[model samples]
Target: MNTNTTIKDIQIISLPRIEDRRGNLSVIEKEVLPYEMKRVYYLYDVPGGAERGGHSHIDQQEFLIALSGSFEVVLNDGEQETTVSLNIPNKGLLIPKGIWRELKNFSSGAVCLVIASDVYLEEDYIRDFDHFIKSKNS
Candidate 1:
């Protein structure tokens, strides 16, 4: 974990929204993120009252968008915490590495689109809170 990083480092990035008579479209280009996107995935069909993402990344950064419904992202930085609600399709939450995060309070039919800075690696995740805290202190 990066001790210098805190909850204050979390950012909400807005994408370009082009409105048309038929519908609206949002685009995410190379310049939209601090890191190059190497992977993409989404979460859907989440049951009510359930949660996801109870871990912290070692070096991976991610941008999450609520493409359909709404959800709350609870972020914790060893000593501080914050919660961000994502509900707009054109807006996203940019989460840097070293911050602990959990996704919860998802509305029915919610879709979470995630653009990752790197491919998935099991060793890159700190799955335990105690371990994450220790890494932050180290």
Candidate 2:
């Protein structure tokens, strides 16, 4: 796995939205994303001021979107950190492997949609901050 990644590597993608008189529609194709999506999941009904996602992946990548409402994503690359806000349905954040992420500051009734590059695996996750730093140094 490549450990020489930084928070700058993260990408914000703007999806195409088709507006009409009835309703608006947004489309996401496989080619538009940075990786081929293998898993799809969503986070909803989070209590106010709650947080989620506090780990880094070894071989998985993810794309996160705010389906409704808004929230913040805090990203850390063992050295530097930054926060990104997701409020628009047509905008998505692409998070590559080796970066630790934390989701926080969710508004009421917010829905977070996530698309992953790989299936879930326990061994691929770095749950400890010390371990993540060590991995990046090594």
Candidate 3:
């Protein structure tokens, strides 16, 4: 494995909150966070006891937020790992590059929002766990 450390800001993101009598809204924009606009994705209706995102990106930084419900994200920076649980909509986890991450232990009916620092490049993503390890080492 690479054994290289991924940049992690210990500070949680504080999103802009707008409230009204009917409902409230929180916005996540590229300027709001530290990264520039690249790509955005979301995962929803994740089955119980199921998992997703068992992979890593070589040069991608992302922010993960739970829009609804909750889930656990296991991030391994080639050595020690950190477990980040997502339940709040206004806060997000800054996921640095060159780290292996797996989104597992998903609660029912969860929505995950990811704002990335790069465009959707399949070649940039290490989709397989074994390949990710090998590429990290190389």
Candidate 4:
């Protein structure tokens, strides 16, 4: 793992692999999926320079992977900041709750897979940077 490009101090956990000639299978089910996966979504066909997340979740946890092409996920944990560039299908960055995250610098044809711990809810999101900073400490 690259320290400078780390999203968090928690070493990014790589998903387990199950190889096969027919079709390699990997599961992201429940608590067995490295970190418990509660929700899943994928971002695709993104235009150049378009950003995805510009907010932070109050309690939801997430793990993001580049299923195809490449992109960067910038993370801020109140004080320090880090940027992670993911370009591998099998590799993922686990983002814990309370961290402000923004997804950007997406390469054309990039496909991002996100596994989250909670369903989509507008109320669960902290879209304001000021609120995120305040909530990080609270």
Using TM-score as the measure, which candidate wins?
A: 1
TM-score per candidate: 0.98, 0.97, 0.84, 0.82
Regions of candidate 1 where Cα sits further than 4 Å from its true position: none
Q: Sort by TM-score, best first.
A: 1, 2, 3, 4
Q: Write the per-residue lDDT of candidate 2 for residues 1-138, one digit (tens) a residue.
A: 448889989999999999999988999999998789899999999998789999999989999999999999999999999999999999999999999999999999999999999999999999998899889988
Tell me the TM-score of model 3: 0.84
RMSD of 4: 5.0
Candidate 4 lDDT, 16-69, residue by residue in tens: 678999866666556645555667899999888888898877667788889889
> Which model scores highest in lDDT?
1
- lDDT tens digits, residue span 1-138, model 1: 555788989999999999999999999999999999999999999999999999999999999999999999999999999999999999999999999999999999999999999999999999999999999999
Ranking by lDDT: 1, 2, 3, 4
Candidate 2 segments whose C-alpha is farther than 4 A from its true place? none
Q: Which is superior by lDDT, 1 or 2?
A: 1
Higher-scoring candidate on lDDT, 3 or 4: 3
Q: Could you give candidate 3's per-residue lDDT for residues 71-125 as a string of tens digits?
A: 9988876546788888989888887778888898778888999989999888878
